[model samples]
Target: MALTGETSTQLALRDPDIRLMLRVRDDDAEAFAELVELYHHRLVTVMHHLVGNAEEAEDLAQEVFLRVYRGRKKYHPKAKFSTWLYTIANNLALNILRTRQRKPTIPLNVRDSGPLGPRPAEQLVLDRHAQPEDRIQQQELAAVVKQALETLNERQRIAVVLNKFEDMNYAEIAEVMGLTTKAVKSLLSRARDNLRVVLQDYIHMNEPGQERKDEG
Candidate 1:
């Protein structure tokens, strides 16, 4: 069962990472490293998907830690440790995207504009087919899906990534994005719609191929 607000707050207070963060507030260097060790890969992976580049994602993840360290003295358990961490990440990513928006060098959003209104294809490979994909095919499909993600507006991209990649629910995504759950739902709806259109050919390929007829 999901925890209630009070229970969640209480749990957050008791969480090991929260404890570690508390220690960090006391200038415990080891606590800082522990927090990084715990969240580094997860943050990097999520940021990588968001930014569509490993190097940028790594830089962003490090920045998150730096901000966390600097703000440790003011740390308060407003939410779970993970939720707080993601909030920082969300802010940094928005800044990067906004900067990109003003730059002529960066490619802007690549939305799928067509007649296809959305169907759920949040994770392209998983949603497109029921049969299991072999390693190579899955990798190829993942690359396509990653490209599809870049097409979304930044908010939708963040929402979809949190929902699909992190397995976060609408509420969690809302918290991370600082939006309402309803807003998160709308974002994900639009994102999935876009993904469906972009990956339409691949999805169709996953279906049983039509048999050839020998017409005489």
Candidate 2:
């Protein structure tokens, strides 16, 4: 459902991004450019993780911007601008993924690292001041975490990527993925469990210096 115009106006006053999007809706070229500049890298990173190919990710990110441009006239601040943006991204990525499922083929440029998140391995990277060996271990652990991420189903992966990388809460993730908050929580729980199982060997081999108890 669309937000009432007055509600959208209230949101636009609160969120600078929504204000910029409103400018875009008004055909302000510079506002659209600025919006693209701000979101380009973030959208690309997300698309790359979702599709598992850098090239495809770039194309998808471009497509997302194109969509925003095309839909400018109909823009409504129904939610945070970022949430609306990612909702588009999630839909596009899932469409591509579903297509792949129908006709499986070897992805030519599959990325090694999965979407980075605040898992135990990621916690190891929080210490900015680390020895060379520690950095190496962090890199290796990140790769392992990425691999573990690949073990999850697509919805689980999307939930994790948005929650971990985008720093979105469960409600935001739920909005992006078009799921209930309860469903989002369940999806994340299952994804975490799957990652724990996959990474158990690595975790045991290299126990984290400090346990991380944070969760969305």
Candidate 3:
């Protein structure tokens, strides 16, 4: 059968594992393990952005999952599954930031050499007619832009990450962060403005010359 939104949502809502989660409310062990497998990595990635360290992020993520398992019996479907999951992530991340008493830092110079590599700007330089020197300058400019994003407040940072990286729309971000759509838009607008200012030099420097345009 073709999946309709209602049907798909119902299936997830009444999923065997979610049903198992219902069982977990009654104190089922196996059901909890199933929940763990489903959300662990996703939770970790969200937390890593909030906490800014892989190890502490992983630890905090585990705690959030554990809270879910413990609270399963009381689980209610007031929101979508992902929404509820992100609510947990957001709360945990906020708590971590508050307790640690450290300002958020975005590491501009850090190269993405890991299994999952850098942002597109870092990985791809679209200089059609520029020489190698120009490409090097563009890469440095991209790094500065990335760093500026890091300096934004936590809400703005999260909003940018979800909207840009995860492709979430305004409503989805509002749901995830418990903000209004207007608020989400404001956050993104501010972030974009900050990024534009931070990368102004790069933008001006990289503008296509009239010769290049004429050729096209």
- Judged by TM-score, which candidate is best? 2
Question: Is candidate 1 or 3 superior in lDDT?
Answer: 1
Taking the tens digit of each residue's C-alpha lDDT, what string does model 1 give over 1-216?
124565534765678888888889899999899999999999999999998889999999999999999988888776778888898999999999778757635432344223353322444434446553443365566677676877788899888888877889998888888889898888889889987887776674455452223323
Best by lDDT: 2
Error of 1 at 77 (Å): 0.6
**What shift in Å separates residue 74 of candidate 3 from its native position after superposition?**
2.2
Q: What C-alpha lDDT do the candidate models reach, one value each? A: 0.78, 0.79, 0.66
lDDT of 2 by residue, 120-161 (tens): 344433433354345446556566566567667789999999
Instruction: Using TM-score as the measure, name the better of candidate 1 and candidate 3.
Output: 1
Looking at model 1, residue 147 earns an lDDT score of 67
| Candidate 1 residue pairs in backbone clash | 118-193
Indicate the worst ten consecutive residues by lDDT in candidate 1: 112-121
Candidate 1 wrongly placed segments (more than 4 Å): 1-9, 104-140, 205-216
